[model samples]
Target: MSTAGSPSTVDAPRTAAGSAGSDAPAPPPAPRRRTGGVLWTELRRGVGPWCGGVVVVVCWVAMYSKTPQWQGRWTETTDMLRSVALLLCGPLAVAAGCWQGGRERRRSTGDLLASLARTPLRRALLAVAPAALWPPAGYLVAAAGCTLATWPYAGEGRPFLSHTAADAMALAALGVLGFVAGRLIHWRLTAPLLAAVTYVGLGIPAYSESPARWLSPAYQHTYFWDRPVWWFGPASMVWTAGLAGVALLGLAARRRVVALLPLTVACAAAVVLTHTGDGLWRPDPATARLVCDDGTPQVCVTAVDRKLLPSVSAALSGVNARLRGVPGAPDRWIDGPRTPSPGREQLEAAPGAIVRRVGEPVLLGPREAQLPSPFGLAERGRVSDPVLYANWAVSYLFSRNCPGSGVDTPAARRAAAVNDAVNQWLAPRPYAVPAPLPGDEVHLRRLHGMGPAESRAYLARYLAADLCRPDEVPVP
Candidate 1:
């Protein structure tokens, strides 16, 4: 006999008689298969993620390959690689997390899996398993693919070496953030929104005038290159840790809805609590401290090693002399070339004068640096350091034989005219040529104006200088 709806004796399995039983407890039902291996199985099912990884890698290869910078020394190419990685890979990781999380939730598998005997921690990890492994795998594949693509084109040091060690670590952190996001948000709508918000928050301010803006992920100074700011190391760790914590907490709450509300509230509260009323992050005083060369320049004009020191010195000297020749030159001083060790190469100068490499100039100075804006005439040419500007000035002085010769020919003039028209349409601030034509060589030499050496140097260093300004900083 059995209670209503319960299995009756006839339907139930009959126990063996006492003699067959031998007091052995019925095998305990195989202990209900452990859920530990779920993480492994889930991770194995990340083929879509792998394919996505492949797509990202392909894009990086294609894009970076097309950049003019990729054609030169392995060193520059590697920096570009790292910059592209930092700029692109982070968002991709977040996207991976969102996709995997949404799929699991949409399938209703998360609820089913969570109902199993597995501990919540194991369950959370299992749910995030795909994101955890795949994004990093994607980053690794992207990085490796870039290195491989660049290998045949490399002239010196392994192209991979040109990429900084920090990139790998940053990518790993990106992956973890993605994985954590997957575990926390199960809804399709919320997952992507959350990821986007996080990404925007991390990147928006690195370009801000405030030094604390360095807290922004985009502020990872010297993106592909190197910049030494010990402050960023700890800040990055803290931020990553905080994000990881929030992600885990969101996963472990009693209910998903309840878990989510707090994150929004916390973010709101932080905004209120930290608000300075100003539109920018607070500047750190240390930011003003000029990192000096003191014989060991990390990124300044004097940063060049002894082997290349002579060349760098010669370039600086030439620039100073040329500028002095200007009728009303600003006061000039060639501070010993100094820079932070392990920084993107640049020529530092006092505020009024732009200091840059002759062969390669840095583009970090204010707009005033490009004084007399030579518009609708020569396009931005091989202008790097002040020395290079001198070189360019001299070169331009020589390029023309007379007012209508060389680049002054009818075709050249027509091209310039067309370019000037196009520039009018594209420029945020349209400008007209100051003179009907660029000055002749004689005029340029006499005026100490923009020269040929400057053009050549600009051509060589153009990419580096252009890339130096933190993204979205609007070339200052």
Candidate 2:
């Protein structure tokens, strides 16, 4: 009772050091680390995997459908598959990327993601990686499967790995670019708009005649028969990588304006690199050079068509037998200059060579009767008259000398009249004629019934007649 309030406090057990009113705060818990589980969850739920699967299925179907076209040639198979993949997958990947980027905005998660300790660039990369990577991965998987299937039937030349890689890179770059666009533009229609734009941009170059079309990743008009310079693959890869890099840099940069510098430089470099020369590709010597048969009446074909050499050689040898000793007759049989197609075969005359197509039907049927004497006319059952074909052949081989104008002209008409007259003299017999001829059947019969000696002399005079001077040409 002597010390009052101070004596009373000391007497107590002196409970904890802070009495009952302490106000100290506890330390905050540590931030969560970003993990692969998150990435997997995103990939599983996002459009990337589904889009990739769709792309794979589409490519498989397309490749299977065109099996007849590519089965004979390895380079063509790979090149065509790669081109189709690029054309279809590129647009789909871009659309997928756009949808992926727009998902966050649609969910209103921008603020939430930004508030996390992870940097925005890292967030973007993690989010966009699945879309950017999956399409190309799917494409490669499909390509591998296709190659394996076609391996047994494939023709000469190995697959062009460099071109395939370049195409894959371009597809990835498109996906990344689409992601960036989606992230920047918050419109609901951005995904479809971007996809349409990308498709049109890529497609225009394919149809365009300009050399600058090579700049487009989707502009793979060059076929397997030709090859670009060695530098083309690397240049394309660099250009596409640069495009993707610019998108990434732009997303990560603190200053938006500075991010454009790399993009601008890359674009200029790409233009220069892609514009390698006046043409996108040139003939490959290994494929284009003549591979000749080891025999008389030498038969030659491009290396790509070597598989058909045996049949081609046999066919041309028959034609050569009939053409022996003729002035300006072809000494060698070579593949004609024409676009490759199935069953659409043709032949043309060249200096010292008769250029014909492989697998042509002209080689089949009656050996002597179907042998095209000139301009590829034959005396098969389909012909209206054998004499008509013979006379046409003679005039075409000896007299006609105009370039193929592909239109009706005076020179062509006059040449036709001379052939008709010669045909009447040779065969007075008539079938289901398409039109009436100038001479009567009795007169034509008299001319046709002539003796062998007189007939041979008459034919000599007829063949020697000048078609240009129509009035002077002999008629029945």
Candidate 3:
């Protein structure tokens, strides 16, 4: 007989016969929230404090360190932006699941929840909602922060990251993926270890020339570079859809047979998509430029030069050889003008030779980046070319304030001046010329084709041949 004021059969008191509490507040009326109903509530309850803490900590550290500039620009470059997503989201997701998973148990409400035709899995899903939600939320926070940070640094008329929409979706998908993976393996020891492994694994490809970056569950947003994976947007929608199907089936399955198919197929597809063309596709150079046509933006290749192509090939070969000598060096590359290195002594000693670098960006303040030479020579040069008016300007500035590099004596300084004049006369405008033309004007062409050791020897030999004298070459 059902009584008007009695608890339902499933939710009845768990006593042997007549154990009763007269004033238990009616067991809070079954919580009014079902197993799946507390999604947003749990998400907010779980991730709110942690997100607040993260913002506070990141802001404090960044401010404390004075927020060092990256490559002479603000530290909001493309690679660092991607890192923001990874660092903030990946951990939040997994932690959210484990932290909130046992909420009911912690509050002594587990028995009541278990009686609602719910499995451990359904309740686990509720617990992990915060975990899933936090990563995406973190992405949004990071993206918004980056936009504000980069706004002041925009070039010409190009808006800051025209493809901001694509990037946001991509980050959200990756965060969701990470949160789900964490919820699945909620082991105390394994969760953190798995999170770390996933973090590193996803990062390797995103920074590489490979397409594996698109498949990574950690990339939330991408700059408007012409990477093929960006064409699919950041959400990795196909993969995320498949993952959702798997998660839903995983929730419903009661036995091994019922669970195997969707998961196995989904996982296999993921693996294939991630590793499809590991060593195959090569992105063309000149693809890094941003493009715009009637509000339709795309990443497109701009120009190609075949002149002195051998030098480009030789530079790449040298890089590969260096990587072979050093373990764990990144050997792959996207062919382009190399960005100038900062804060290091010149890696190559040939002063007249243009140092060619691929895939690096030209940054501000190149003069301060110069390193002290091994010899007591005070190395000095600011203009891109040291063989023309730029050379003369640098030479005049150096001789006035500092002794010339490689010039041990006053006579050597005089001789060094002679060398500079001849170099300027012969090369005319070394700074204005592109790398290909710059190297050819100063017999730096001979510097190529030779191996590193041989190239050093040739630079010495070329310096000895002074076809022109200082008195004959007038100061500009």
Candidate 4:
């Protein structure tokens, strides 16, 4: 065994394995370059990339136009992109697809393409790929850019990827339909007319308060904190993709009967979409939950907006300072849609009234952010005019369920003027405060002359009295 030039057991086994492995046949090389060449030809030669470029440009511009509204929030970002996909890119994609579809007919090459070895389905898919896929690619790019932009400022929650996927499917479906239309009709004006009709058609259903509006991918959403039902995105995808599949199959498949399956699926999806309606959305507990900052007269916003809490707190800092130790001040200023709503009549009243909001603020003199609606937030991201809005919010709190809602009589006017003066003296406006009607100057001077503790005491008494009855209001 140990004879001269004899191999050891380990070396012998290793050599044998190496020889065996080397003798085995190699795998076929992948046709990567060929596949790439075909794709390059399709993208480079066709109208697909051009259509995609148009989408990129339009979506980028639209997103930047309203950057402040959506940049700091994931929900806003996703919804904004969804709107762009449906309204602008969608129509353009349809027109482009139709134009692309007519190319083979214009060149008289339909017969040539058919004569090729590829199956009808393969040819159809290959031909339709450029038109249908490009718009979604453009959208994907825009979506990525938007998400990256929002990353720095976003407060909470991930982007609604399902919404984005559904939106892309919708664009592709529209493009597919337009392609089929072009194949059937060769008129040049047909594209423009389809675009116009489709645009109008999308809008017409929106005016009707029916569930059909929900079937459109462009339907509006009001709340950022609400999430779609788990199946909504999948349902939307199925509905659109199914319709597209049916259209493509009807146009190119050898057997037209194959279209029936997709047609049936689309119908079922459409039914589900129609029946669900607004019920598709529900409050996301994580986003809707209160996130409060620790401060006397604490400030709170939804957990989804936690990052913006500091800004909100800063906005109300001056007002909070005034109300922190006051005997009749609200313990916290809560901002959210879920803030308990006042009954109808009380909700409608004017400022300087004894209104109870979320308890213990007997005097509405100092509450802030009673209504944290997205409309208001969108108008001013991070509350652009915090001092002014803070002042306004405080004034709004005292407005509920009081006879002071109307200043019909001269006495009521005087009471309102005094209330205005007290509000101004408590929270100074950034700009010159307008003198209240019927002269609040005298009361304002009296309050300005008092020490801080004494002034707070007088404010307590004044707020307790019925400001609507001039006789009952304390002379500061």
The top-ranked prediction according to TM-score is 4
Model 1: residues with Cα > 4 Å off, grouped in runs: 1-37, 55-59, 66-83, 144-187, 191-199, 223-238, 253-476
Report, for every candidate in turn, its global Cα lDDT versus the true structure.
0.43, 0.62, 0.40, 0.76
Task: Report the C-alpha lDDT of model 4 over 68-154, residue by residue, as the tens digit.
Answer: 678877878887888887787888878887987898999999999889887888777777788898998899888989888888777
Q: Give me the runs in candidate 3 sitting further than 4 Å from their true place.
A: 1-37, 47-49, 52-78, 102-110, 117-124, 156-191, 203-214, 217-230, 234-237, 240-353, 357-476
Candidate 3 residue lDDT tens string, 61-123: 443233322111221244344454455444544444444443554577868877977676666
Cα TM-score per model: 0.47, 0.65, 0.46, 0.79
Regions of model 4 farther than 4 Å from truth: 1-40, 204-208, 339-383, 401-407, 415-423, 428-451, 466-476
Best by lDDT: 4
Give me candidate 4's TM-score against the actual structure.
Answer: 0.79
Candidate 2 vs candidate 4: the TM-score winner is: 4
Candidate 1 weakest lDDT stretch, 10 residues = 371-380
The clash numbers for all candidates, in the given order, read 24, 0, 6, 2
- As a whole number from 0 to 100, the lDDT of residue 388 in candidate 3 is 38
**In terms of TM-score, which candidate is stronger, 1 or 4?**
4
Show where candidate 2 strays beyond 4 Å. 1-37, 221-225, 255-265, 279-282, 293-298, 311-329, 336-476
